[model samples]
Target: MSTFKAPKGTFDLIPPYSATYLAVRDAISGPLRRSGYGYVETPGFEDVNLFARGVGESTDIVTKEMYTLTTKGGSELALRPEGTASVLRAALEASLHKQGNLPVKLWYSGSYYRYERPQKGRYRHFSQVGAEAIGAEDPALDAELIILADQAYRSLGLRNFRILLNSLGDKECRPVYREVLQGFLRGLDLDEETRRRIEINPLRVLDDKRAEVQKQLVGAPSLADHLCDACKAYHSEVRALLTAAGVAFEDDEKLVRGLDYYTRTTFEFVHDGLGSQSAVGGGGRYDGLSEMIGGPALPSVGWALGVDRTVLALEAEGIELDIPPATSVFAVPLGEEARRVLFGLVTELRKAGVATDFGYGAKSLKSHMKNAHRSGARYALVAGERDLAEGLVQLKDMETGEQEPIALDRVVEELRAKSA
Candidate 1:
């Protein structure tokens, strides 16, 4: 047996199964396009400091999950662990932020890398369908992005996901709450890693998943309790917009995203069945990130939904994606002459927007028929020397096992009529 395998924490999306993945990506990106979000692609690797500084030095993504390498040129580069920072950097480098637009709305779908423990819904290498609106920080913009994500999920018939919302307050209030939260956490029984989180960004400490730690810190100060007047008003407006749009969300006071630049709001998307990796994806307001990244003072909000986690959610709910068939018609040539002629005809059919496939080898009629049955084709066209001499071919309905003679030149037209 061959010994080579896909890299750990990565799997191949082979044919048929790959169809579902592509469908999900297209479905998610479709709404974003209609919503005035353009597509953008960024470098897979960037200066290591881009992530360490933008993603936050305190977060696990920078401190532990980053895949960094030292180049011969003496520069340190890292495979991007997330999309937001790369997108922001790309926008700034290209001056897209200065296009006289309030917000540069864009969407991206691609692979991201992280060095971490591989588990269900979590991979060292994974895929994300992320959206970002740079340049403006209106509560309405945040609500629009959230609603777009919601629309994408619902369009896929997903109903079991939860949108967890919270306001981490702004610079004015978050620091005050951070100090109070850290003081309270310092006195609690916690692990060294989490205790350090309390020091770097105490709000992230509230995100701990340990039961004991959770229970001990249930009394910890909530961001809601410390929201400044302006922040409180902004949070209220976002909640109101979501509610008015019929998007349900649970107020999660502990949903402090582990990023130093995130402010005013934070959120996550969770599926109950995912256990410890319950978060399918999430994003929220980061009004100060642009300034931190050496860009203009732009306020923005965005989210990255794990495509792998999304597929898992569909599986957990026992919902099957209706991936379309690979080909609509299969051509069976009975002889060498027929094979040569039908080969060209199939190409013509495909050129006319028909999905067509043809048997490659010279096999028994019954064998090809059986193969056609197993090929997932709606109709099979059989052309033999005798039928070709008569300017006709046999049309077989693989589903009903019915067959008939049609003019060889009319096969494409007949298939179109049947499909329509």
Candidate 2:
């Protein structure tokens, strides 16, 4: 066994299982691509201040989970705990917001790092496929993002996941709500850490999971009750669009996501099967984020779906993706001369866009055929000295165990036809 191992809470995806990850990423990105959301990538690490300022310092992700580092040059950097901040920073640096485009639509897939006690669906290192629509404040954009995510999940046969929606009242009314919440929280029996949160970010206290703390929050104030007319109208239009689009969501009064940037139209996708870590994905409108990061006021909305959590959700539902065979056609050559001829055929087949593999070294026909079976190939090509002499090759259907001889020169064309 190798001495080295992946760090705790991290995993290496290999083989057939890894295919699911690719499928999930593609499934999510496909809709965004068709909808005009171009792909954008950013470095895995960035100035530590970027997240502290953008994701909010009081949030648990900034205070406790962030993986930080200090360089020899005395620069403090951090592996991004989330994608939105880095994505926005890249867009700002590139001046995408300055372009004529009102909303610079984008999609990205990558790994994010955080430090936490990993559990079944929660990990220290995980993957997410995210989409963002920047520089727009329209409720339609918010509805579109939620619709796109819903379509992606439905296309993947995810039936049990539900959308939790809320509007975290925009700047107009949030201050008033915060003060009211502070008053309520200040009167509670709380710990020093909880009390400190009350001052820095009272909304975060509503998200506390501790049963004892939750007991005290039974009569706490809710933001939905204090949303001003403008915020209320904006949220109502978002809900109306989603309803018209056939997307169902439940109003969740307590859904103050871990991030502090969200304002109005906040949401989460949760699967009941995922236990306490129920959220598979979530995001909201961040109208103030660009300004917070020293960029122009570019309102944005986005969501990052957890690839690992999605996989777990699929397993819980007992649904298997219809993945094609890794190798479509595998060739087994009986002799050295046959090896040269079949190797050429393998190359030709692959160049023709067929997924093909071949046997290596000296091996018995039976053994090579066995390897072909294990490869999950649809067809296996077998050519021995006698067959080569006749310029013919045996094509065996792995699924049906049926074999036939075809002209050697016509193998590639025949396989392509059959595979297609």
Candidate 3:
């Protein structure tokens, strides 16, 4: 049979590139761990109603891209297109809110499925590093989340990213603004789908990427102007805190997020290097989402940063990720007797917390050394018959090409000391 290919819109993270994925995960999660955001995981698919309600019925995720299926028992489920809805569902089910902690801080790294036409940086399946803070409405919390995300991107030595901030107007005034927005959009000559959006969520039409949609949106009533006194005050507080924290942001008057549940504060991280698809990551506050999903009124805010997009951003900026070297040592055996001894010693070295590998299936010395270089081993141990008889091994520094003999019994200790 011909070799099977991966499903359309999805690709495998094979070998050398897999290391880069791991590095990005570690680098991003480090700050969250230190900041006291505990790790949480949820099922890839949950009840279909979860996203329909939590993510919103009018959004593209539930309306267009969700992969839904029915179990044998007849319950409907869907592969999660985003993490926040699932996380919030779990938190509500577990009653994490009632645990007396004001804001339940969570950090997650996992795959999300979206059934759409895949393009560069956008995929049917992708991994994300996301953070959520539930049960809090403090502007400081909003600023904290933005600052930490900024810190993570900078820590990776990534430049050419801009943080855009906006407020979607709180409940006290957003409904009033939505009416004005809807009225204005209804007058524009647009597609039936967009006009339908004006009836459902007038704000979402602003997020449309189509040039045709953009051209007609010029005179639409902006949410920023429609904000009531209370909504305006809350937005000012968030911006002030962000500014005080030294995080610069562009005030985007038309930055309506894709999701419908967001209220109060919203923001996005965009990279200039990645053409057309400039958004590397973004998050916003969803004050009413908990109530929307049949839970109590719990306010929350979070962001999901795209790992694949971030890597693309790095490549666009002509930046190289400083990945760690693979194996530290490669063991080369001259003969059967030497192989037997070297295998045991290899195990001992590993037990001492060293990354060591052996040349398998009795390859020639030249081929074994070439394999060592290919594996990115820094040092190679040559255990020949003579060295085995003498209870010693020759250590050759791969890069330096310098060799030295050490007693076999002290192999682990010697390697550890030298690597240290």
Candidate 2: give the clashing pairs.
none
- TM-score for every candidate vs. truth? 0.97, 0.99, 0.98
Query: Across residues 258-362, which tens digit of lDDT does each residue of candidate 3 receive?
Result: 888899899999999888889988999999999999999998999999999998988888878888677898999999999899899889889888889999986
- In model 3, the worst 10-residue window by lDDT is 317-326
TM value for model 3? 0.98
Candidates by lDDT, descending order: 2, 3, 1
Candidates 1 and 2, the one with greater lDDT = 2
* C-alpha lDDT of residue 217 in model 1: 81
Best by lDDT: 2
Residues 225-257, candidate 1: write the lDDT tens digits.
888999999999999999999999999888877
**CA shift of 319, model 1, Å:** 0.6
Better of 1 and 2 by TM-score: 2
For all candidates in order, the CA lDDT equals 0.87, 0.94, 0.90
True-structure Cα RMSD, model 2: 0.8
Worst 10 residues of 2 by lDDT: 94-103
Q: How many backbone clashes does candidate 3 have?
A: 0
Better of 2 and 3 by TM-score: 2
